[model samples]
Target: MEPQSSLPDDLLRAAPKVLLHDHLDGGLRPATIVELAAEIGHPLPETDADALATWFAEAADSGSLERYLETFAHTVGVMQTASAVTRVARECVEDLAADGVVYAEIRYAPELHVESGLELEDVVAAVQQGFEEGMAAAGGRIVVRHLLTAMRQAANAREIADLAIAWRDRGVVGFDIAGPEAGYPPTRFLDAFEYLQRENFHFTIHAGEGFGLPSIWEAVQWCGADRLGHGVRIVDDIKVDEAGVAQLGRLASYVRDKRIPLEMCPSSNIQTGAAPSISEHPIKLLASLRFRVTVNTDNRLMSRTSLSKEFALLSEAFGYGWAEMEWLTVNAMKSAFIPYDERFRLITQTIKPWYAERMSG
Candidate 1:
């Protein structure tokens, strides 16, 4: 018998999901943004929540990564104060929990939140506090962790890396660098990556999305990234012939051989021009080749998606069944920056049993 038949929207939403590439600032609720913006007197392009949401989706649909990222100014503008940051963080967890996310690593740049004179540590503390409150509200249904990101174009990666290490024991699980990838290569943050390595910390770099193979190469071979954020562009090194055979170049071979996780956000990738569309996305080929591919909602508000919505879209595009869904979910859990035992427990205890029941039923 087949592992499963069709994936209904309800089943997809009920599946236990693990997310690794969500952005804290990028996933705010529409109403939250309007409320916070009004309280802070931050001017917005659209005053109504529905109109603001539409504006974000429309503006982020620009085909350039830089232009797509320009939408963050509004989200980040409303998140300057501590209470605003905490409320956004808490709501993020609540939203993910409602969407059936069992675990998630929400990333944001602390340096960006310091525009209102909040210290880096203070920003981190506020986020952690909100996470704790959200988790408490979740009642053990979902677990959330922070991945402190340093803007790749900035000069404070080392500082952010140190901040991640200091909070490593608390709630911050890893580190990352995110920004326009064309001008700022991962090597520019070599000191931070190297420091994280020396300190025995984990990190994932945003590469192979806005830029191509060189950025991915430097992130993996040079910076020792634990994962590749939005790594859909690794397909650049993969050549396919008319006979339907694919040849992997040195970088692609290395990425596959080492089992580096690729956090692919299908809808968000289409928005940022990483992939032309979901049907033609590299994720189809990469996952077929078993390249440790994992699905994610890079930015819920921008992409107008959730973990469930991403899976639903993939199911429609790729004819994915419960088996494929389970594989992708397991891939994410396995690639999480959390400890091996924790990952194993969640995979074996939580993720596996649910999929097994669904398949058997």
Candidate 2:
């Protein structure tokens, strides 16, 4: 166990982690956004890099999903062309790598990036190229897989699923549904999920963030998601007593028993008002209850965080130790959409070895 205030800088740098729920457009570098917007001649809310960063952080703190989502218009406004998509994807990989991420599944809806009249497949291809270039530049083994998201409020979910299946072996590893959570229930995309199921493609659903257990239940029972994105409100399904003990509701019990991974994004949860604050985030509670909780950065730019920053905050708020961090790392790797053999290899060869060396040294 390592104390947060006393955590060695070396340990922070050496921690090997996996990220599974980051959004591609949501994590762009402020400097890159400025440069990209300049190239595209898209007007941004603020031109100054630091000021623009502040704008995103402030706007995302509005505590409403609609406002939080509205911030993406600028990011996507510049990402309509293939070159921008490629560069963003590449820079995203490099940024994650610098934070010691070994693997990441970066997600974005291809439909939104096609405002330039490029087809969906071209969007995927451009991102794939960027990921490859970034991985090569990282000088360490950092693997990135694209999770093709279909905006839940949109009408082209089935088409997106088809595209996901089409690119299954070409760096698109999974499918996802991301958009306003209130009105667009998972049921709206049941056809897409069913199509993905038939194709044997892996997918995750955005649920239980602004909504509650019913959304999570629908994602699991109805949509058949392999993982949950920002499943923070699944906390509503648990009953805690005065003695600090807990009882699991049926859905909670089932999710635990079934080992469905909850992609818990602590900082983003706080910013989005999904959780009251980081100190009260359900991540600690869910981890204590062994609910397959994994740490993530849902939106780096908006939340003003990276994976290391997310871990640092959790460690500070909860007094997390190395074992808890290791558990989270393993949980993320295990819950990754990659094949079982690749996940196991990462656990055995990379995660374990890296942590073991750090502990010993």
Candidate 3:
């Protein structure tokens, strides 16, 4: 196709992609946020869409993780009612499909949307309805699933985990715990993780971004997270000498040997100070070592990125061609929380053929 190493934005945008770490609240369109905020009487620093977009980017550009998280307040503030949540969720799917995402698992905290007297289950139901509407409108062009998340600082893990298991057949595919990862550890919700395991459900934990190897260790070894969210910190355990020789510690070796997928969000990592920059992201080394790395956009609005943007940045930094791009997309497809047969069908029937056609032309 048109010069693999220098593939233009249009080609990258047309490539079928898979995303695993996107947040529903973090990816809202600025206009939608403005409208929703005005309807709910939630005041924003800037009411104009462009100004609000710039505000989110600039506010999240602060190198402090805490500062980066503060940008979500406006997004979450505008999504309290069922209609608003459904609108945001439906728009999220539509946006992803427009960006050529064939399959995605969009995550959100139901607890964060219950301020309007809507029950947590109602929040889940609203988002699920929105997803179905979005999928139907797409005519099966994209498949969307939900990852029910519990705020780490809250005490609702057991409740949200139960909600996920109860609604597994409805739309929920997995469980997660998100929020600050400093004083609040994944161990705080071992019961929820164990419950998910006992019920034969899948889950991923947010670890190794704001914290270090200890957080990753607790999520993997203690709580048995199926995948590590923003797991860029696993690099902490590996030692690279002056001569470029690499030595893997026990924990690093375990993660690598077990083929644990690291849902690495490049721009978000840079904004959160987890990684210095996209060029220096550990995804380069981890992918090179075959550590089951997957690419994602943690927050589209905050980072002003799409899946294509992430691939474009990686292509520029690492000179990745079609083969490497396919490798990353397939890795994410294989690590999806969807059932094996479904995941395989998407890979074989959709992803492979799409990329093969473009790459060979």
lDDT digits (tens) for residues 1-361 of candidate 3: 2223476888888899999999999999999999998887899999999999999999999988899989989999999999999999999999999999999999999999988799999999999999999999888999999999999999999999999999999989999999999999999999999999999999999999999999999999999999999999999998989998789999999999999999999999999999998879999988888899999999999999999999998988888978888999999999999999999999999999988987888
Off by over 4 Å in 2: 1-4
- TM-score (all chains, Cα) for each model: 0.98, 0.97, 0.98
lDDT of 2 at 247: 93
lDDT of 1 by residue, 36-138 (tens): 9999899999999999999999999999899889999999998989999999999999999988899999999999998999999999999999999999999
Task: Give the candidates in order of lDDT, highest first.
Answer: 3, 1, 2
Which structure is stronger by lDDT: 1 or 2? 1
For candidate 2, write residues 1-361 as lDDT tens digits: 5345444555765588899999998999888889989987999989999999999999999888888999999998889888999999999998888888999999999999988898999899999999999999997679999999999788999999999999999898999999988888999889889989998889999999989888999999999999999999888888899999899999999999999999999988887889888888989899999999999999999999988888888888888767778889999999998899999999999998877775677
Candidate 3 clashes between residue pairs 3 or more apart in a chain or in different chains:
none
Task: Give the true-structure RMSD of model 1.
Answer: 2.1
lDDT of 2: 0.90
The local lDDT score (0 to 100) that residue 319 gets in candidate 2 is 86
